[model samples]
Target: MDGDEQLLRGRVYGHDHDDPDPGPKAGRTYAELVGGPLDGLLLDIHGWRTEEVDDGVALTTELSRWPGGRALYDPRPGEPRAAGPGIACRFYYSGDTP
Candidate 1:
């Protein structure tokens, strides 16, 4: 389980929007920032709403972006399946899926 947990804490190489002149920098993604693996992602939307940009198909297809691994997606209501054991907290993954 610890190894699986480790999967969530990997640094990835991607573009950072906040940086005006953001060069190539490997930073931890939302999932990775929370300690998720490259593909060990968990996309949990507040409503998993349907949209032209992020439809279920598009969301599922996004998984392909992963190098080579599976993502644990949970698009439930406002609350994720399990934010954390014995923890009373909630998280919503918005346009920050990448």
Candidate 2:
């Protein structure tokens, strides 16, 4: 796995029906790990791919809540071997919005 993929591993939850533990039953989500100890790392939200709107909403909302958090949405096609679909969304710690 790449750097982005590795950072996001096991950090995404609450959306996968296949996962034994989905996520929190209520309150804030555990998706935003950007400004925490993993500050310099880049996380690929796409790798956590969720078709459910609720999951997406939760992620977006959490990212928005963090002042230093940044999210980049890439609509281009991704590698076939990638964990996610042919699209990318990256989340990281950046005070500046790109």
Candidate 3:
């Protein structure tokens, strides 16, 4: 797919504000969020620590609660072949928190 199409389908996350480019870049890697409300969303895990990715993170979403809430997701073992290559991890939705 083209850059524009990928950008539209994926959303960047993590603490890499220092990087000049925050958005997805050409050939950049990301993790796919599976299941839950955030399903099908791509999380940009570039520059993220290995432990952080392994432990999982709470992704803020506007899908739940009046003022919004967080969706907890954990990285599953191995890459999700179904998502195709470049998708380095598969974060499965555990639950939601307000």
Candidate 4:
């Protein structure tokens, strides 16, 4: 991985059960991710080379359609603390093991 890729990789916060507070802030609101209008919103999942709409409602609905997949919110760093952090959705798929 190159320097830029490494920096972007550093932004991704993988699932951590032990640590209560992962480095990135959890996105709880749609407005937090997309600034103003929801139209033409795009989400990019680093390393995975995938992008989707940055809509909370749409994402939640889509997540439920997946058999064993779920979505998570990971905030970006070095933004205005008060304005709330920008979020990137991370989806995880665990094969049927129930």
Pairs of residues at least 3 apart in sequence or in different chains that clash in candidate 3: none
- Candidate 4 local lDDT, residue 19: 57
- State the lDDT of candidate 3 residue by residue for 2-98, as single tens digits: 8436644555554344656555555666777788887766787766777778889788877644237898999776644333235667789998888
Sorting all predicted structures by lDDT, with the top scorer first, yields 3, 2, 1, 4
- The clash tally of candidate 2 reads 1
- Per-model TM-score, in order, reads 0.21, 0.23, 0.65, 0.21
Full-model lDDT, candidate 2: 0.35
Question: Clashes in each model (backbone N, CA, C under 3 Å)?
Answer: 7, 1, 0, 0
Model 1 lDDT per residue over 1-98, tens place: 67534543332224333546432222312322222332333232323323411222223233343544332332335533333322112222332233
Question: Residue 75, candidate 2: how far off, in angstroms?
Answer: 12
In model 4, which runs have C-alpha deviations exceeding 4 angstroms?
A: 1-31, 34-61, 64-68, 83-98
RMSD of each: 10.6, 9.9, 5.8, 13.5
Give Cα distance to truth, residue 49, candidate 3, Å: 1.6
Best by TM-score: 3
Error of 3 at 30 (Å): 0.5
lDDT of 4: 0.30
